[model samples]
Target: MVFYGVSNFITLFLLFLLPLHSALPPTTTVQINSNSILVALLDSHYTELAELVEKALLLQKLEEAVGNHNITIFAPRNQALERDLDPEFKRFLLEPRNLRSLQTLLMSHILPSRIASHHWPPTHLHHHTLSNHRLHLTTNPTGAKTVDSAEILKPDDVIRPDGVIHGIQRLIIPRSVQEDFNRRRNLRDISAILPEGAPEVDPRTNRLKKPAPVPAGAPPVLPIYDALAPGPSLAPAPAPGPGGPRHHFNGERQVKDFIQTLLHYGGYNEMADILVNLTSLATEMGRLVSEGYVLTVLAPNDEAMAKLTTDQLSEPGAPEQIIYYHIIPEYQTEESMYNAVRRFGKISYDTLRLPHKVVAQESDGSVKFGHGDSSAYLFDPDIYTDGRISVQGIDGVLLPPEEENEDESSTPIRRVKTPLVKVASKPRRGKLLQLACSMVGSFGRVCS
Candidate 1:
């Protein structure tokens, strides 16, 4: 009887596990054909759209749709999705809970029937989408083809036997999707607000005191320079003496730590010396950090620093000006700088030197700073990054274009002689001589 009971228990457990095993996906996935329009869409220049489709888990659905009949897809150009799209709306669509809305949005871009650019109707025509939403087809006043409000930039961009893709200038969002996003955003905004007293400012620091704990990496409400106590010059104010209450971060310690890191980082001793022994700006920089201002230091290596002429450093506040030009009042890592250059081709950043900006561009797969002969490559990236302070080492010193132009203009030019072209007929010397002779003869003096 005991053996029979054990057998029964084992049988019941096996029965419970059987359904789960059956629910698992089959060993073989339905292979997508190389020539299918769906495959073309995935492999075409519409990479951003393809990524979103994949993220929305609509690949299988698209595949199924393509398998049934011919279809057309209106793809938004990468720029439209990357730069022109509303960031909050994009966020709303990408939320996991709003998966249905995302699916509807993507589906609204596709039509059941293949409609090429040439086949578009002259008059307004309404068609049903894969999401069963109505899309109005028409042309603009200039005769540029348009779907709803977005202009078709590239007509029949990618054509396969199964379907066609038209690139649009912007994403054509459905009204339903817009309403849904607005609703979600409103709710989020309401929930994010806290019932707190008026903001307080520290008299010494001149920074607004946070009522609650701020998230890591959050930008300060005020500009770094604004946080400085009233001062006559652009130079950083002397660090406050330790008497009042301290903030969450020990800005002084963080500054010291990074300076130590620069010393140990092998190629950056000159930069360390400038921050520590060479100047008192380091103390002020630490105060800025403690007041919730971040900084990115573009440190020139020892070799680069050695190239600086004595005249460049001999002037009053010259060293401070040079260092100020290198320090950006923001926290940026290697990945962020590289990404910015890669995306925008060129990016400009404001530096501590008021009104001067640093121009960065993508060069040989790295961030190149400054311009012309004075440019420097980001050689040692992210040498130090501790949420508030960031340091990047470079192979060459960076100088502003104005300063570079000034140096070039100041260089002594060697004098050279050339055969001069007669200008203004040499002031009519022959005529003048004739007049002189006539006047001298009349005056009873012999003409030479």
Candidate 2:
């Protein structure tokens, strides 16, 4: 019995020693090179974020830094980047001249230590980012956590020996960059780009004066009123006079004038700024207008534009798409729209930007576009109606068909039906008498 017990003990000791000898080399190697695992995760799951890091030339710095410190990255998702970033700001960061600013912006998302979501405190905590900027963290009563203005969408996405990654919903713009953007947007002089040499103006109409002596073999000058006349008018409007004041109708100048007029007198400065600075659509529109192409634009008021969220406007090419959706290829006036409704009961026009159509119908003597719950009306129609361009003021912004469908699907529908009831009592003498009684009662209540 003693011999057998000793033999079993020897076998157990050898088994333990064998595992120790085999596992020592690999375990130490994995611990030393574990930082690459986080890099791999970024390349695989967070490609967009990875690309931004590479563009800023931050991958080398990250590699060197990861070896020494425990890092935490507030990485934005691809969809979030596509949908929430301001296009102008994104372009600014990608510019070669702004490499330092771009690096600072990227480094601002990294913290020196691992900070998991569960480690977040109830009260606000100020943490310094790698760029030496202060990042504020707050947790609301409802358990929503935010880092600066950006919300943390997914936390603890990757946990490695060297670091962790938390997905955020928006790009965290550094305060300095944001201030710079604001200053540039507000202070930039746009008048410097206006066309030189003012054309002679007609005192009565405030329009450019026509030059005398029409050239032979040139197209006749058609009256602006003729194009505004009612009927099936599908042909392009007559081209503006060459070498006359009409030549001053430079597309860039007209666009500038249109935007400036709205900003100065129409209380649409916010919308105007958005068009000028945010998207290239303003230039495109100006080019088309300069080429003497007739166009109609349904301009949304500032109040209507204020209702749009960052997510709604941040998608790639979203601003241009929205602006294009508002423009109609054909020049349309209020009179023409009314006449069309009278003749055909409705009118359809193609938009300049998308493969979408804007359908108009007369409702209570006013023109409304789109259908059902997606309809928008011209609250201030015929704001500007020259021969070449017509501007109508709309009450709401129009969404594309796909967006409308998504909106409808997400909204809850509550249908309530009114039930009919039969009464045994005799009816009143007449409908006019009942109306008179109700009006008298309403007046009495008002007086009281």
Candidate 3:
């Protein structure tokens, strides 16, 4: 008994420490002259950015003392604070809600050593933030160097012997991360990185893949209209049968009902477009109905839905889209999700409502949907109906898998969140919508 107890304790200790230890990352050591940089940061009255820098510095307990460590610091200037408290900027990078996540992000700004000039990790390349995120960086080596996809308005302000500095046009942040931006981004344009084209990209090459041709006998029109176009009035999805759109909902009528149960129980009224947007499922549904493939639908509850804005909720296509994005056309459950727990393990599936993905958390047995608003989980499984779709309710909203940009091919670093809804459907509520994005963390579930 004593031997067994000791062994179990050791194993438990190792398990507890493993993640924090493994996440320990590379640190940059640059020799510099400005010893006062540390002092300036530690001062309680220093600027917010300076305070953030100080907090970061204190946590690391650096031997460099700002100048001692040869370094480059991308420091924001006085003019940048004109809108510090604004909701957009404040809300940017707000999730992960802790210092470790923040540290990871702040560290992404540092490279292995003091890079004297504008050179690599890749010019126009995006790097992973310490927060385990990817931020867009653009370098105009010819015109002037820039990072974080922002213009360096005043480049290379040396902090004398301590480090180098650059004044950027906007606050630099990780992509799909808007915690800070919401606090200060009243001036930002909504279309900065709205890449043109469909979200599907080839997994192997990281390029956009052509939508597969509709199956040989499939319907002529895309289901974007048929599956999603509202009926004259609301009606329960038809039973699993020859009638209705053969590519049954959520991969089955049961999945649809499962969602209705979630909404009904959570006090919501309808579903989103997760169902109609999955081209592949639409294709498969046309061919096999429910007899093929296991499917799982991660559902969003009313509380999560409540965060969306009236404009987002009232947008003409909003309701349809919410349903489509939330429902997967196939069936997958907690067991499968837990099995596939690493980067390559996640599998994307099509849905009557939206594109869906299932990712696993290896340590915890619980399986949550892959994105924002999807933190919720099923109360129980085995939802059955005349409709064939089987579903389990989750607390948060479901998000589509992150598809890569064709031009960027196979880059390991990618944005955590991708916006799915166009602004036309979302009302401009300033920061509330962006701030609320923490719950969804991107993946277009920031509906309001």
Off by over 4 Å in 1: 1-218, 228-244, 403-448
Candidate 2, 254: how far from true, in Å?
Answer: 20
Query: Which scores higher on lDDT, 1 or 2?
Result: 1
Query: Residue 330 of model 2: what lDDT?
Result: 76
For all predicted structures, in order, the TM-scores are 0.42, 0.37, 0.32
For every candidate, C-alpha RMSD to the true structure in Å: 23.4, 27.2, 30.4
| lDDT assessment of candidate 2 | 0.69
State candidate 1's TM-score. 0.42
Q: What is the per-residue lDDT of model 2 for residues 1-448, given as tens digits with 9 covering 90 to 100?
A: 9999999999999998998898876632123353563565556578877888888888767766776788889988888677666677688778887788889988999988888888987889999988998888889789998887677889888778788888888778775665454334323332333333323446567455644444322322333322221212224433332223343245565566556446423446556777888866677666555534567888888888898889978887677677777888677888888789778988888885445878888888888887875678878776655455677888778876764555476669897998989879887669898899999999999999
Report how far off residue 414 is in candidate 2 (Å): 69
Residue 198 CA error for candidate 1 (Å)? 10
Encode model 1's per-residue lDDT on 1-448: one tens digit a residue: 9999999999999999999999998775556689988888889988999999999999988888887888999999999999988677788888899999999999999999999999998989999999998888887678899887678999999999889999999887775675566446434543664422323457778655655445532455556666554333465544432212435455786787677567534568888888888777788788877656789999999999999999998887788889888999988999999999999999999998777899999999999999999999999988777677889999998988764554466579887999899776456558988998888788885433
Ranking, TM-score, top scorer first: 1, 2, 3
Model 3 global lDDT (CA atoms, 0 to 1): 0.45
lDDT of 3 by residue, 152-254 (tens): 6765544434445555555554422232332123223223323222223345664434545433223222223232323323344322222222222223333
Task: Tell me which of candidates 1 and 3 scores higher on lDDT.
Answer: 1
lDDT of 1: 0.81
